[model samples]
Target: MSTSPSRVFAARLSGLPVFDPAGDQVGKIRDIVVVLRPGGLPPRVLGLVVEVFGRRSIFLPMTRVTHVDSGQVITTGVVNMRRFEQRPTETLVFGQMLDRQVTVRGTGVVGSVYDVAMEPERSRDWVISRVALQEGSKRFGRKGQTHVVEWRDVEGFAAPDGVQGATHLLAALDEMRPADLANVIHDLPPKRRAEIAAALDDERLADVLEELPEEDQVEILGALDNERAADVLEEMSPDDAADLIAELPPETAEKLLQLMDPEEAEDVRRLMSYEEHTAGGMMTTEPVILPPDATVADALAHVRNVELSPSLAALVYVVRPPLEPPTGRLLGVAHIQRLLREPPSTMVGHVLDSDIEPLRATSSLEDCARHLATYNLVAAPVVDDDGRLVGAVTVDDLLDHLLPENWRDTPGRPANPVRIGGTNPGGSRG
Candidate 1:
C-alpha cells in the first residue's frame, strides 16, 4: 500500500495547472518536472508543462502553485503575471533535487517527520517521504542535526539555497512517539501527509496512531486497508480503541471488528461501555495472565508462547487457578526474567511476590505513578474487587500519561534517546 516518494511526487504534479498568484488565468501545463537527478540524469520540474500564451510550452514547477484543489488552481505569489514569459524545455525548477536528501520539517510544536508530495496528473513520479530534521547524535554535537528533504516536496526545482530552511524540524523529530508522528502530520501540508501515509507499513502506521490526535484517528484509519486498520487497532489501548471505533462509520467499524479476534473485539466493546478517558476505558484486557499453581517452567513456556508485547515479559501476573476459582482471582505477580533465573521445577506460587501492587478499575494517574515509583515496578496489575486480574499497566504506557507532548524538544536538555524500528538512537531529552 505504500508508494515511494518518487512515485507520489510524480502523481501529484500531473493534472495540476500553473497559475499566477493573483487568481489571474496564466496558462495550462505541458510536461513532467524532475528533481535530484544528476547531469543528464533528469531535469526536475516543480510540476507540469504549461502553454501560457496558447503558443509556447513552459515547464510549470509544482511549487508555483498557490492553491491546489479539484475546483481550480492558484499560482505562486513569487511569480508576477504581467512580466511572465515561457521558458525552454531544458529549464529545471528543482535544481537541488539533482543530488540531495532533504528532511521534512515538523510543525511548530509537534515532533515528527513532515510529509512531502507533488500533485498527480503532472506526470507519473515518486512522491518524497516526509522530511526528518534530526540531530545525528549529541556526542557528534547538536550541530550534527540535519534536514532530510524528500524529492516529493520539490514542487519546482530551484537551487538548493532557494528552498526555505526549516530549522525546528530536527529537535521535534527526535524521540517522537506514534502520537507525536500523528501530530506532526497535522502540521504538514496535505500533499506531504498523504505521501507519508502512503509510505508507511501497517505496523509503522500503528505506531504513529498511538501518537496521533484522537480527532484525526478515523480519517487516517480510513486511509488504511481494513486488514491493516484492524491490526493497528488491535495494538492500541482500549481507551483509544473506543475513541477510534466511535469515529468510524458503523459499517466500517463492523467490518473491521469482524476481522479482529473475537476476544480483542470483545475487550474493545467492554472498554467502550465507559466514558472516554476513564480508568475502565483506558484499561486493556490483553495482560499476560498465568495460574497460581503453574510451575516456573509452565510460566516460562507461556511467556515464550503467548504473543505479549515485549514490555509485558518483563512483568507478568499470576492469577488463581481457573479450576479452584472459577472467576479467576488474582494471586500474585512474577518478573519473567526473575522467574527464568530460578529452577524450572519451582512453583509459580512459591516464586511469585504476594505483596505485589494492584490497581482498582478506577485508579487515578497520580496513584499509578506513585505506585510505580514507590515499588520500582515496570507495571501494575488491575484487579476487580472480586480479586480477578483484568489488565495490566506498564511504565511506558504510564509515561504516556505523564510526559508533556514536546518534553524532549526543550533546549540543552538531556534525554533518554528512544528508537524507532530496530535501530537505537540512544537516549534523548525527556
Candidate 2:
C-alpha cells in the first residue's frame, strides 16, 4: 500500500477507474462501503461498490486493493461478479452519508456533510477519519462556509430518519449517464431514492425516469407534487410519459394530463390511445423530421442535435407539408450516411429511400421488429391510416417493449466471472 495516497476524499473517488494488477481496467468506483462502530468511533472502511460492465454493481474488498490515487484505483486483480447488495450493518458513504445534516460537538453550528476522508489506521485498515460540512447559505447562488473536522466531532449520523440534501451526492454523480444514474438511484433505499429523484431538475429527472424500472418510475413520480410531476411528464418523450401515466390511477393520470402543456399533452394522449404493443404506442413523436423540399444540410443539422439519441438521429424522416407528427404524407427516409454523401444543396426528397414500406400505427410489435430487421434499419416511420407520418419507432424503443417487464432489474452478467489472485477466504462475494 506504499503507493496509495496517505488519505483520499470520498468525493474525489466517485468515478475514478479501477484497474487490475495486470493493468486491465475493470470498473469505476461508485461508492465506498463502511461499517459503523457502536461507540463514538470512526467507521471502518469495508470495501467499494464498483459498477462493472453491464451496469452491474459489485463489491471490491479493501484487502484486495493494492494502490489508490487521484486518477485510479489498482486492485489485486480479483473481483466478485455477483451483484452488490447493501447489508443492514453497512452504510454507503456517498449514498447514505453525503448531504447529511450534522451538528458540531463544541459549537452549536449545524451543516450538511459534503465529503469524508479515509486513511489507513495503525492496523493498516482504512477508516473514515474526517467529515466536511457546509453551513446553510443565505444567498441563492452562494454556498455557505465549509469546515473539515474529525469524524468524531460531528453528530447526527445516528439519527433515525430525516430529510437529506442531495447537493453533494448529485455533484459527485453529475457526469454519470442517465441510465447509470438511474441504476444508482434504483439501488438506494426508498426514502433516499425519492429524495434524490425529487432533487433532480425536470429535464434530468425525465431522462432518468425513462431509464428506471416502471415501479421505480411510478414511485418517484408519485412522490412529486401534481404540478411538478406534470412538468416532469412533459419533459419525458411522449411515448414514455404516456406509458408511465397509464400506470397511474385513472384520476391521477387525468389530472396530470390536464396540468401538462396542451401540445405535449396531446402527443401523450394520442400515444396512449394505441395498444401498448403497437407501433404507435412505442414510437417517439419527436424523431428527426424534415420536409421533402428541405436541403440535405437541413436534415443533417436536425440530426446533429446533441440531445437526439443516436438511433433517432441516424435517419431523417422526409414528409410532405406539416412538419409535425401526422404530417401530410410520408415521402421516405434519408439515412445520415447517405445525407452526408449527398451535396448540401440537394433536396432530401431526391435522395429518399422510399422503397421500404412504412409501418402503420396499428402494426404489431412483432411486425415492427421484423420490418427493421429485414431492412437492416435502426428506425422506421409509423404512419396513420392516410399514410401521414406520425412518428418513428427506433430499435431501442422496440427492445424496451420486447424485453421482460423486469429486465431492467436484472442486468446481464458474463458467462464466466473474472477471478485473479488466489481467492481470499475473508472476502464477501457480494
Candidate 3:
C-alpha cells in the first residue's frame, strides 16, 4: 500500500535538507520561488532556491523534486547549480510573501502575516491555501492569536493590477534572521541589493553583510561612504571585518580604518598580521572574556550583552587582572553550559578547564579544524607566545574556508569574496 505524500507549511519548509535520489545531500530549501497568476488560480511554483552545501545558492526545477519529507527533501538527480535570479513575476513565498499587512476583502488590515500556507495544485505546483496571520508582530514575543484565511478572502496590500513587488517587504525583511535576509539580498539586482543594505540598521546590516559573498561585500561597502562603511565594520566581528577590509585597495582600506573606533581598529589590525591559512587568521576578536576573580554571574552577564554573537557567547575565556575588557593573559576557559550549572556566586576561575590547550596564532587552518573536531568544540581560543588571549577561531568561519575554494562558482565550482589592511596579503583563509 502506498502512503499519502506529506504536505508542509511554508514556515516549516524553510531549511529542510534537499537530497538527490541517491540520498546524496545537494543543499537545503532556502526559499520557494513562485509566480502569482491572474484571476483565481493559485501561484505557480517556478522552482526552488536551494542553498547548496550552505555556501552556494542554486535553482532546482519542480520536476527535480521527488519527495518532501519533514526533515529532508528528495530530488530527481537533476539540478541547475547556476545562481537563482528572481524575475519581475516571481514572489518568494517564505522570503517575500511573509510579513505583509494582510487585508481581508472586507476586514481591511485584519493583521500582519507570518507565513503563506500552500497546497499542492495541478502540474507539480503549490498554490496558496491561506494567509497565516499573527495577532501582533511576530518580531516581538507576543505569540498573538494566529488566523488562517483562504486565498479568496485576502486582497493583498494593493490591487492585483497595481501590485509591482512587495511594497511592505522592507518592514517584513527587518524581522528576518540575518542569514535568511542575506539569501534574499543575494538574489536581488545589484542596485536593489545596495538599497536594502543601506536601509538596514548598523547592527542588522553588519550581520547581513557577514553573510554576503566577498564580491558583494566589497560592492556594498564600496558603495557606502567611508564613515558608514566603518560603522558597519565596527559592528561586525573584527576577524570578519578584517577579511573584508583586506580586499579593498590600500588607500580605501586605510581611510575606513581611520574612521573606525581606534580600539576596534586595533583588533582588526592585529588579526591582519596573520596569514589567512592560520588559526589566528580565522578567529574573531570578540569572544566573551572574564577576569579570574569574576563570579558566574559576571560571566553570564558578559554573554548576555546584545552585541555578542551566539558563537562568541558559547564559552568564556578566563584571564588575569587588568581585566576590564578581559583580553589579558589567558588562564583557562569554561563553557557557558558549565557556568550555568554552577552557582551564580561561584568564582569563574575555579571552573575553567586548563586541559584544553589553546591554539597559537601560527597554527595552520588544518590544525585549527582538527582541534575543533577533536574536542567537538564550536570555538577555540587563540593566543600569542606569551599566552595572552588575542581572539578565537569559530567553527563557522573555519567551515567556510575549509570548503573547496571554487564552491561558489561552479555546481560547486565557485565563492570571502568576508574581511583586514583591506584583505591581508595572506589571503581569504577565514
Candidate 4:
C-alpha cells in the first residue's frame, strides 16, 4: 500500500537524511532558510545553507531534499564547492534564525516549532533547516516514524529583537531534553557556547542548563545572575547542580548560596559533599511532586507554573505532605497528559495508582536504566532512605549518559544547537 502524504513526506525525509546538493560535507545545514513576509505570517522554506569547507557555505534549494529520516537528511545530489556561498556578516548560524519563530503542524493543530541549531562549517551562515521537526526522537519525547516539514511548510519568520514580529518561542524551544541540548552545544565551538551562554535570557539559560555539560554549566553560570543561577541550579540534578556551584569560587559560591533559600542551598550543599559523578553526587534535589492529596488540577498547575526541569514534566511524583518532617514521600507518578485530563479537583491519591516505582540516590546508571526498563517509565523518582522524593530522573536524563559525546553528529538531535555570543558578549539581552 502507498504511504499517506504525511508518511511519504516523513518516510522520504526521515530516513532519507540531509546532504548538500553541493557535495560539501563541511557545509552541513545551519538553519533551514524560509521565505517570510517582512511582517508576521507563516514562513516557507526557500533554501538551505550547508557549511562546506571551513567557513564556506553552500545553498540547497528545497528541491534538493530527497528524503528525511529519523537519522539523517538525504539530498538529491552532492553540493559542488563552486556553488558554496560566502559567509555572511554574522558569526553564528543561529544568528540567521534570530528574532524569528515558526510553527510545525502534526495531525491537526500546531505540533511544535522550528528552533535554532548551529552550522559550524559555515560560521557566517547560521540558518539551515531544509526540514523542521523530527518525529520518533526522544529529545522532545517524540515517538513514531519521525516526520520533518521542509522550510517550505513553515510560516513567516519572526522579526529580530525589538520588532513586533519577534515570536516568543521559549516554551517550544525549552521542550527539548538535556542530552539534546548537550548535542547542540557540542556542535558549536566551546567559546561560542560560552558566549551564547552569556547572551541567553534567564529562561533560555535555564533551558540550556538542563542539557549542557559540566564544563558548560560552570562557564554559563558565571554569566548569569545569582538569582537566575540559583533558579537554574534549583531545577538541576543535584550532582549537576552541585558541580556548577563547586565551580564557583569559594566566596562567590557562598554568596550565591546565601542568596538562595536556606532549604535549597542546604540541599545543594549536601549533594556538593558527595564526589562528582557518583549517584549521590549526580542526583537532583528537585523533582516533580504533588501532595498525595493534590488534585490533577494542582499537579497541572505545578507543571505549568513551578518549572521543575526544563522541557521535562514527564513524571510528577505524588508525595504526602509532611506531618512529622517535610520529607517529600513518594506516592505515584502523574504524566503531563494525565494531569491535564482529569478535573482540577481530582485528588492525586484517588487518581494515583498504588503501583509506585522509585529509584535511590545511590543507584548507578545501570540501576536507573533497569528501573526505567522495568516500569517502562519516561521518568523515575529518586528517593532517600525514608522514601522521601529528593529528585526525579527522566528518561532523557538517563539517555544522556548513553549517548556519544557528539550527539549532534547523529540524526534526530536538534539541528540548531549552538547559541553564539552576539555583538554584546557580556550581556544576556538577546
Candidate 5:
C-alpha cells in the first residue's frame, strides 16, 4: 500500500493500462469495485474491472495488484481470466457512483458527485476516502464551484435519492469504442442503462444498439419517444434497422417507419420483405456500390470511408446504371486487394472478378455460407431474379445468424488463477 499512490482519483483510473510483472499488458482498468458500508463508513475497495483483449471484462482483486500509480497498474503475472459478474454486494465506482446527487453534511451546499478518491487505511485495505462535488452554476456559460471533502461529510452515497445524471460517467467513457460501450451498458441496471442510452447522440446510440443483444435493444428503443426512436433507426444500417423493427409489434414498427426519412424507410422496408434466413434478409443495402465505369481511385475512395465496416469495405460491387440498391444488372465485384494493385485510372469493370457467381435473393443461409467459404470471400453480392444487385452479405451477417440467439451473454472459458508471487485467493470464480 505504501508503494502505491496515496490517493487515486477514480476518474483518472479510467482506461489506464494494467500490466503483469514481466511487463506484458493484460488489460486496461475500466472501473473500480467497492462495497458500501453502514454507519457512513468508507466503502472498501474490492478490485478492478479490467477489460482484457476481446473486450472481455474480468475482476482483478486488489490482492493481485502489486503496484498502482497514475501511469499504469502492475499486477501479479498469475491472474484469472473469467468474466466479471457483479455480485449483489458489489458496486461499480465508475458505472454506479459517478454523477450521483449528494449534499454536504452541516452545510447547505448541494451538488453532484463528479469523482471519488481511494486510499489505503491503517488496515492496509483501500477505501473510498474522498468525494468530489460540483455545485450548480448560477451564471450562464460557466461551470460551478468544485469541492473535495472527506467521504464522511457526504450525506447521499448511503441512500441515493432522485435521478442520477450520466454526464460525468459519459465523459469518463468518451473515448470507448461502440462495442466496448455496449458491454458497459449491458452490465448496468436497466434504469441506468436507459439514462446512458438517452444521453448518447442518435448516431452513437444506433451504433451501440447494433452491438447490444436484441432484448436490450428493444428495451432501450422502447424507452425513447417515437420520433427519437425513428431517428435512431434511420441512423442504423438498413438491414439492422429492419431486424430491430421486425422484433417490435406490427403497429409500432409501422408507426416508426412512417416517421423515418422516405429513402431510409424504403431501404428498411425492402430488407424487411425478404425471409429472415435468406441472403437478401441478412445483406446490407448500403455496401460500396459503383457503376461499371468507375475508376480504381473512385472505388478506393468509397471503401476508404471511415464509417464502413472492414468486411463491407473488402469488396466493391460493380454494376450497370442506377448506383443505389436494386441497381441495374450486376456486372461483377472488384476485390479491394486486386484494386490496390491496378492503376488508379483503370476502370473497375476491366479488373472485375466475375467468375465467382453472385448470391440470389432467395438463397438459403447455408447456401450463402458455402458460397463465401468456397470462394474465400468476406462479402458477396445478392441479386434479384432479373439480375439486379439488391444488397451484399458480409461474413459478420452470416455469423450473427449462425450463432446461438444468446451468444452475446455467454462468457469465455475459465483460466488458471495462479499469481506470480502467490496463489490467488479469488480463484477462477471471479
Candidate 6:
C-alpha cells in the first residue's frame, strides 16, 4: 500500500518556491488544498494551490508534487497550466482559511485560526490535522497572540456556545462543503442559523442558501437587508435564485428582483414563469453553446473559456445561426470527446449527434431523466417554443427530484446537517 502524504501547517508553505526537477523556480505556494472530511477527523490536504508567472493560479495535485519542506515545494516538473477554479470539495488556504477564529478542542476559544495543517491523500484524499490560531487581548486596541492547535484538539466547529458560539462557528464553517454546511444549518436552531447567515459573505451565504429548505431559505433571507439579500440572490444560480424568489412574499421578492443586476434578474424572472419541477425550472440558463458553423477548435475554446465544470463541460451544445449569448436555434449536440478526436478545423455542425430530441420547457422530470439515461448524457437541453436553446437540465439537478425529499438529512450521512467555519489556527508561525 502507498503511504499517505506528510503533515505541514498551511502557513509554513506560504510564499515558498516551487522548484521543477531541473531546479527552475516555477511558482510560489499561494495556498493549500483541503477537503473537509466526515467522521470528525481532521481535513486532509489534497495538494497545493499555486500561483504561476506572477498572475494565474492553478491547482497542483498532490501526486504531481514530489516534496514539501519548511521553505520549499518540489514538483514532478510537469504542470497542467489550466487556471484553478475551486471545486465544491476543495478549500484554498489563503483565500478562505485565514483571519478567522475557531474553538480549540481541549482549549478555550482560541480565536482566528490563522493557518491550517494538512495531510495529502489521493482522490479519496484530504484531512486537516492541525491549525494555527490568533487570540486578541481584551484591551480594545491590542493585537492578539497567534498559536497552533491540532485539528483533533479543537472543539466542534458549530455547536452553539450560547454567546460566542455564532462567532466561533463562523470561523470553523469556512472549511465545510456548501451542501454539508447547509445540512448542518438546517438542523440547527432557527435563531442560531440566522446569526450564521447574517455573518456570511454573499458568495458563501448564497451557496448555503441554495441547499436549504424553502422555509429556512425564507428565514435566512429575511435576516439580511434587502440590498444584501438581493446581492446574495444575484450570486446564486439563476434557477435556484428564481425558485427562492417565488416563495418570498411578492413584495419582498419584487424588491429584491429590482435590486439584482438587470441581466441576471431578467434571467431569473424568465425562469420564474416555469413550474418548479419542469425541465425549464431545473435548467440553468447558462450553457456553453456555439454557432453551428463553428469548428471543433471553436467549440473547445468556448467551453474552456466559460470554464464549465467537468460534468457540464463534457458536451458542448451546437445551435443554429443567431448564436449569441442565448443561442438561437438548436442544431444538435457534440460531445467534447468527439471535438477532441477531430482535427481543429473540423466543423462542429458536421460532427453533430442529432439523434436525440430536445426537452420542452414543460417536460416532466421523469421524461428528462429517461432521456438522459437512454442517451447516456449528463445534461439535456431545454428549449422554448421558438426552439431557442434556453438552458440545460444537468443530471445532478435531475437527481434531486428522484431522491427522497429529505435524503440529505438521513442519519449517518457523510454530511449530516450544515455548519461551516474555520480560521487559520496558530498564533505561532510555522
TM-scores of all predicted structures: 0.50, 0.95, 0.65, 0.51, 0.93, 0.59
Across 237-344, the per-residue lDDT of candidate 3 in tens digits comes to 888898999999999999999999999998888888789989888888778877888999999999998777677788998988655332678998999999999999
lDDT of each: 0.53, 0.90, 0.73, 0.52, 0.89, 0.72
lDDT of 4 by residue, 319-409 (tens): 7776221255677677776667788888877777557557777788878778778876777776779887666666666666556754523
Quote the lDDT for 251 in model 6. 92
Those runs of model 4 whose alpha carbons end farther than 4 Å from true positions after fitting are 1-76, 79-196, 222-239, 246-255, 259-261, 274-280, 304-312, 323-328, 334-344, 404-430
Q: lDDT (0-100) at residue 164 of candidate 4?
A: 19
Q: Give a tens-digit lDDT track for model 2, residues 1-430.
A: 8888899999999989888777777888999999988788999998998887677788898888889877899987777666788888888998999999999999988999999999998888899999999999999999899999999998999874978979899999999999989888887888889889878999999999999999999999999999999999999999899999999999999999999999999999999999999999899999988888899989888988989999999989988889898888898899999999999999998999999999999999999999999999999999998999999999999999999998865756643345633656325723
lDDT of 5 by residue, 1-430 (tens): 5689889898998999988877778778988999999888999999998877666788888877888977899987666766788887788888889988899999988998889999988888889999999998999999899999999999887664468888899999999899889988888878888889888999999999999999999999999999999999999999999999999999999999999999999999999999999998999999999988899999999999999999999999999989898899999999999999999999999999999889998999999999999999999999999999999999999999888887776654323222433455453323
Give me the candidate number with maximum TM-score: 2
Give the TM-score comparing model 1 with the true structure, all chains together.
0.50
Q: Using lDDT as the measure, what is the rank order of every candidate, best first? A: 2, 5, 3, 6, 1, 4
- Greater-lDDT candidate between 3 and 5: 5
lDDT of 1: 0.53
**What value does the lDDT take at residue 1 in candidate 4?**
10
Residue 398 error for model 5, in Å?
1.8
Per residue, candidate 6 scores C-alpha lDDT tens digits across 1-430 of 0332476666667667787777777776766766666667776566776556523456676666677776777776666555555665664455445544567665576677566767654554546777777786788978678777777777544332333324445554456667656755664456667767877889989989988878889999998899999999999988889888998989999999999999999999988988888998888887778877788988888778543556678778888766543567898889988898999999988999888899999999999988999989998788888888888888988987777766543322111111112242111111
Off by over 4 Å in 5: 78-82, 413-430
Off by over 4 Å in 2: 413-417, 420-430
